[model samples]
Target: MSGGKAITCPACGGKIEVRAAGFTVNLACQNCGSLLDVSLPEVVLIRRYKNAKDRFALEIGKRGTVFGQEWEVVGALRRKDQITIWQEFLLFNPYLGYRWLLVADGEWQFGTPLADRPQGDRNRVFWRGENFSRLGRDQPTSTTAVAGEFYWRVKAGDTANATLFQSGETILSREVSDGEENWTQLVPVDETEIENAFGLNRRSLPRRKAAQGLMQFKAAPGMEQDDLGRMFLLAMAISLFAAIAMALLAGPSTKTSSMIQVPVGGQIAPVKIGTITVRRPWQFVTIDADANRFENRWVDLEYNLVDRSSEQSIDAFGLVEHYAGTSSDGAWTEGSHHGDTMFGHVPRGTYDVYVSGSAHGWPVDPAVTDAWGSTETINLTIEASTGAMSWGMWWTLVFALFAWPVSILWWRFRDK
Candidate 1:
């Protein structure tokens, strides 16, 4: 969808495209050296990607049985020239362990066949449901279907013990002493298993069986009563210890010392006035106040007449120069200024104070033609000290009082 009207550059009148990446806007113009503001449209497009690789083509379907259980082909069997790779899907039964097979084929190599063997030698392979021991040995114990090729070395004697047998009556075996011969198998699993293993289930399983299973398990009778008494005793001990600790730690709460005294009838406190001038009509100056020494203090300021003939009263048009203070580190502090008097507690350190006010909200007055009175600046500084309090400690005590009772109740009832 189209966005709002495009902005044109002021100098060159070129069309500009404006797009927002996050909080900021990106703007660029194709034509001239003009500054432009690009408008963003309301609708944007999102894209989705597929899992397949670029070169290989795929066809997906199900395959037949392996080890007497029906198996599925999770993905297409890949083929290039004469080589083929087949992947099989694994089905897991909690009652049974893991089982699956994958196969790869190129041109089979011919080798010498072993001839003589003792008669009456029998080798057989059978299916054994699942092996819980194997499950316990691997952490994150759960049934998962993994797609990969696995190689196993088999010998005639070793083949007799296999859980899965080949389709033929005789079992193929290799010599143990001459190094193991590798037989490779591959298993392809459903892509959905990746999400399932990660607990992202598109469909919810029925909970009836789970509910029945939970119903079969229960705590011993009177266990709750026993647990309750133990919890109560623990609560009493903790409460007693906490009370004693608090009493011991509560020695004498430190009192905030009063402001350093200046001798009676002594010299008026020196005031350091800082001046901030606005260069542009729309710009305002930020005031910084140190609250550490002067928190919740009062400051008196008088705007000295620089050129009285052109001087104008800033308060006349229902607009006063507004000043707001924030902490040195950028925390907002509450303070207020009216006319020439400002009062509030400021935290210690540097502050970013915002100052703005005019007959109109706009910084520049269009009708103000008198050049001498048009350019105005304000000067400010500290005037007097206000009383201080240990606010952090006081608030901490208040929070503790409010929370202690709740904490005690929670401790008493936790086991129940």
Candidate 2:
């Protein structure tokens, strides 16, 4: 102020001043509606503009050091859409030139003018090997208010075709008017950062809406989102690979399938099954015995497997029912005649299995089945098998693990 040229307002005859006035070109008269030209040694009049509709939070002429550089809050221009209005404060640093901070509903965006406009393919803006999404179609944004000194002559009633794009937390904005296109890179700033930058000692600031918070600030997803996405992908990959490996391990090398017939009320002689030669590489041995009766009846098979060398008998009791009936709800079917079980760490020894079955849910009157001319005794054919391993539970866990990341990405994009 001391080294600057002292001049009186051309319209009010009041003192017109510029602080740290190095390259200041235009100054607004506070006492009168006059835009003063301060480029020359003697200040002159430009044109008068209207006062702002709302008072500003950051006072004009207040100096603050940001990013190791001191800046003065010089000019401010308020812009409005149909129903929403926000202020853009222009900050000037001697060496850094001019930047702007747009504040809307306590959300802030600090932007710097770009000398070159970004390239866009179709509607997507591309910069720094990243893609940006557009906020809306380009439209006119009108300037509603003007105040303080600026490097350029700006006034109310001027309009610019503006468009905003988002890339992570950064926003790319373009404004064009009268063949002049201005591009800026806007970086989101929260209330804490804004308060610290302006040295405000307030305890709390206004809260942003949940909807608006998505677009108002934090224009891009931070590292946490990217890290989560990568983690989910890793989980899917690892689980998929593990599942395939387990499927191969659990696949049976030799299927020793045999059959035996048992009377409905009687038992069948124990039949010898080949010993499992699979060693520790296979986690466990799975045994499957499917008992089938030609009639529509349930066969409850009391079964047991014995290691012939150790003489340790393992109970393998199971049920096989063939039920198909038409109900009011729909056609219903339940219970397959296939029962499977698994044994952990079965040693390499000859195995023998015995099965005794009883046919239940049979008509007390044989007359009912005799009318259909069926036999009195139903034969139960038992088919036995063994696998190298059992990984049904493990497969379920792996599939669930793979789904976690997919669900996260689903919701993330859905909301975004």
Candidate 3:
């Protein structure tokens, strides 16, 4: 049952039902479409909507149960933005206050006015610990039509600025004017639920026509979605073939190894390894070092590759160590006995390799002695190789190929 009051429209002498009673401030004459102020004891004319043709799915005073709550449709407004037009139905329950049902693009959403402001700047906001990104700049919106009863003095051609932020299915909308600001939280409502609740015929419901111009994309003449898909596949195939060919052409590798002995607490002179010849214009050189069965000792090695022609040195470094001891958790071992380093973009050249290193014992073991009495020494082997290609370059090529098609898709459907 509607807890409403019936009044006479002073402009057209039509009987109007004020559904919200004490809360309703303005109402439209259903017969003459004259705006009337209902807040005062006597109704006063505000404006006349010339040639008004009301086309609404739910009439004023219609009762519906939504979200398990009984609500009456008290008012309705047809609003428009720069791109499209939609309708908003004002719902009222004596105990639950006011809510909104927004219809756009043949879809529906239930809106609840937010009491607390969301946290963030205009570009982004956080609500309930979730982040929302702003959809676009503020849009200018105008009320083009009004019907039934409303709490505020609503009239046609009323304007405001609206901004929207969205995270997944939830949307936050802010509408501001010089005098007032309002925020609403909106969530999608199923069409079936709405139809059952309002006794609506889905086939008779009015749907806004699809928007045109730049909002939608069309394929170029003689090109279809299938053609674009084939082109994308061909581009990927070409990149794949090029990557495989580069990998197969890395050629054979040249290896050179040498062993060196370092006295504890002292440095060893640089040792010369065999020369490396690069057959490719550019390649990567790898150095490997191993110190075996050495406990609590570390050796640091520096490598220098001097080109035979220009004497330009390309330098690199490596470290190898092995330590074992007993702790609260039984025996524990740390550090590696072997390490490797790689140098890239070494231009074509015949280079002579030199290796120098230093050795140190952990905790400064003073009583330690080796076969060379009173002098503890650790022996380590160093190896160098040439002509290997980098995996980094291969992955980079693959990324570029896939990114091209993705960028094209984004450009075409950005507005949609």
Candidate 4:
């Protein structure tokens, strides 16, 4: 009323007024329904806003592989709407070339057209499927200057596409224009049109009936009827096959050997058990005699030996001594050191044991003496000889055996 003249509805030819608060001119004619469009001045304001936000400001640099191809981010553009930030990035790739206005929002919406395709058609295809099929011909780049509430708060380097719409028509219907810019329109559909589009028929198709039909068609719990029985049978068969295969492939039950005797307070009984090679000055035995006598006896021992460090054998030489005592010294002792070799019979008492040995030999410098040396001091409890599947050893073997099957299954089902 104050500045712009009244606009007439294109469909009804009714005179419409431009309200101060709203940018669109709403026309309601008796012949035709309500029609709305932005006036020429409003179009100018919208262009100004879009232009202001397009000014290059910030620079972004990033590199990563997306969808198998390498993509590099060269620059970034942004537009503001109150607290919301609409961003677009300039991306480059060896395969895809340059792409501008890669639309992205806080809501995680992303769409882009092939670089070779027309920009206008690309934008149209993103929102509404490809238009060439429906329109029968390639639509020309939309040139109609749009208006309405399409203002974007501008910052330097922001190149976001501001959507402009008039009535129910999407004015910007293409991804790229002749001038190489993608735009979109945000047209609002009238209440009647929305209802019709959603297949709503007021008196004929009652809302209650429609809701009931929808509920009836909704997916039920459990599996789909089409293949439910077959899938369940297959699952049962698979479980049965797994059980049978495991039973067949499992090794024979390990035979438990009787515990061999280790004589206590005798010449160190020499026994070549496993890979350990011991030369006890008393009797040169790999077994600990004093530790075997009392269930929990701590024996002090000194040994100078060589450890075999091979791919198959990781030899560890130690006195498997245990003890139970309040004081370290007063518990027990038969300290006997005969010619550089020390041997002692100790009761349940904490006694120190030492082992000095070389594992492997110096590779780089052969002259380097005793380069590979390892020592492990452990405190153990000598329990009564109980015959059980050494849980630790059995678990280690189980883990090794199942590793291959577990890895294969993981690889097969990882994506699903």
Candidate 5:
């Protein structure tokens, strides 16, 4: 509001200019520390900052560039709560009307009014997909204690209040003062950067780092979930494929067997199940037995694998038993109805299985047991296969299934 109007301060007799382009209606006289209202032709005194000290390390009327544009320090205002006081340096550029650099205690933050910007939702504002919430604490009205030339006529005792909201890396602030409402974006700044930006001394003011409110949250990390999710999916697919390939190369298992029968009161002869040829030196072998009697019965067998080339026999055993009972609590089951034994790392050779087994009826008890009084039949089977490839692939498949989700979660949180 440059109407080219000028007035003389009544208290200090200093010439004061007035602008009607904006809502300026008051002015402060620098010479005698008088606040004058020039709304009318005759200037009037409003109030004064009594015995105010020169608090600014960089005084008003200073000119500098900030955020890559030229700006001038038009006015400096000091506001206070009951316990602490902070300062806002008013910066103005002809093209960019106004912005603020706030200094509270030793903390610093750059703030600029969201001037002429389209409004977002008042109830729910989001920036870069981050939702903003009110800080929940109300800012008390702070009266302007000092001032210089202003676009708006600023007088002593003019008060303003600010409400804060947080949106991701930025802080959104709403200021309400002097019947004016404007939203502002706030970014954290350190004392050194502030001084360097404004061309002030490095030790310009006390560096108390008054980083309160939303500024504190800036230290926390941000989540970048998409990257982690992608990495997890890729690793999971590769691991699964490798496991499947390994299991496929393990080849098939080969088996051999024999059958034997013994009658009641007759001698039972140990039988040879059959021979297994190990094509690879470190393959695995398995021995199995199926035994039964006419009466309800179970069988226990002692087995051996004799390598024909080395004449070395491996000692092993197996049991096939079944028992069941019903009680008031519930029905119960015990013992396995099948029996088998596995041997790993068998040297390359032909091997034969020698087995001997005894049968028992259900009427027998553990404390006192007897062999079957009738004939029993038994069948033995021996199988061998390559050990390394099959087991490695199976284990890899199991591990990939278990670890895929964990890899995603682990990086997701780590990134945050």
Candidate 6:
């Protein structure tokens, strides 16, 4: 590899080569871990650290064709947020200027700095006619390690505020520092492509010791990483099929329906609707009551299911009300004219169903009359079903099935 200039490390008296001589401003000593500012004729030491030797996938002066352009790896940085650490490589070409290669979360991305700033607020931004929405919150990032050369002055412990916005597969990153604000567009690149370009052997690459230590702990039995995904997917498929079957076979199959007239002046007497036999061990019993087109009036319905063999009784209630009036905001209506009550897990038996209810006026429950000043009667339609399925139970089962896999995924993401 050839470079425009070379210098000696001020702290360790070791040789340092500057690949981008005139444009390169700062660099870290590969031998002594000392940060140096080489923008002037004389070399000035910025910082010194104990840890110097760090392994990188790509080394300085290594030239590769990335995205059809030959770029030389000029610098590398190891940065970290509160939770995870990642690596960044600065690639440069004399004709194309500079580009960035980022490796994090077992993924690789290529970044290009935008000459024109994006337009919009922090939450959303528009660049080149594409809208990008922000993901997560702004995070503080610290440069934990530095190597090779950079165009701008950089040192270990340099901090910046970073925010990421995404539009489809492309990501836009904004980093604000004390001196300047920079925007870079990042697009995901395949790991194989990166490996092929940089002549990297991924299998033999050194792993982060801290991450390896965390992976040493064994996972719970039956909850192995390989089986978790398969189990979750299988369970989801079963749940979906069960849902479709229930939608097709489950009966709210109406057993009986009747229209009963109730005088507004008095309480309604119990009327025997019919008997419904439940063959299943347990099922939901539903009662639907509707008072059609009745305004400013309500009907309260009570149901009684008396078991023939056990002589046991189960009671349920429902209400049907509707009110309409004109307000400052124009005509408005509230409350439904129809309502239903469901009794879940009813034991299998023959039950004689009885319906009784009362009707009254809204706001003021006085005796309503007809044109001749006679008591008015409101008609209500009551329906009964023995085969009502419990949707809540189905959803609860699905959630319980999905919980294990989702929890495991969350844990891995958080600790990664």
Best candidate, TM-score: 3
TM-score of 4: 0.19
Q: Candidate 6's C-alpha lDDT? A: 0.81
The residue ranges of model 6 lying beyond 4 angstroms of the native Cα positions read 201-416
Give the lowest summed-lDDT range of ten residues in model 5: 214-223
Per-candidate TM vs. native? 0.17, 0.47, 0.51, 0.19, 0.41, 0.50
Give one digit per residue, the lDDT tens place, for model 6 in 1-416: 24567799989899888888878898888888888999999999998766687767777678878788888888999888754578899998876788999887678889999999999997799999999987755667999778999999887789998988999999999999996899999999988888778876454343443534324332443355666678788889979988887665554453877888876646778998888877777777888887767788888788999899998989988888888999999999988878888998888888988888888887877654457777777888888888886678789889987876777566545623
Ranking by lDDT: 3, 6, 2, 5, 4, 1
lDDT of 5: 0.61
Candidate lDDT values, in order: 0.27, 0.64, 0.81, 0.31, 0.61, 0.81
Q: What shift in Å separates residue 78 of candidate 6 from its native position after superposition?
A: 0.4
Q: What tens-digit string does per-residue lDDT give for candidate 5 at 242-288?
A: 76765554345567777655332233557777776776655666675
Candidate 3 stretches greater than 4 Å from native: 50-52, 201-206, 209-416
For model 2, the stretches where C-alpha displacement exceeds 4 angstroms are 1-164, 167-255, 262-283, 291-296, 362-381
The residue-level lDDT of candidate 3 at 236 comes to 82
RMSD in angstroms between candidate 3 and the native structure over all alpha carbons = 16.1
Candidate 4 lDDT over residue span 1-416, tens digit each? 12324555454445543323243232212123222335444322112221212222212333444444544444344434222333444445544654433222212222343334323332233334433211111222211111111112222333322332222233332332234554433232333432332222233211122323212322222223333345445555655565565444332321111122322321232222222222222111122322223333333333422234322322234444333344655765332211122222111211122232221111221232354742222222211111112334345655554554445344323433
Instruction: After the best TM-score superposition of candidate 6, give how far the Cα of residue 346 lies from its true spot, in angstroms.
Output: 36
Each model's total of backbone clashes:
14, 3, 0, 15, 3, 0
* Candidate RMSDs in order: 28.4, 13.7, 16.1, 23.5, 15.9, 12.1
Predicted structure 3, TM vs. truth? 0.51
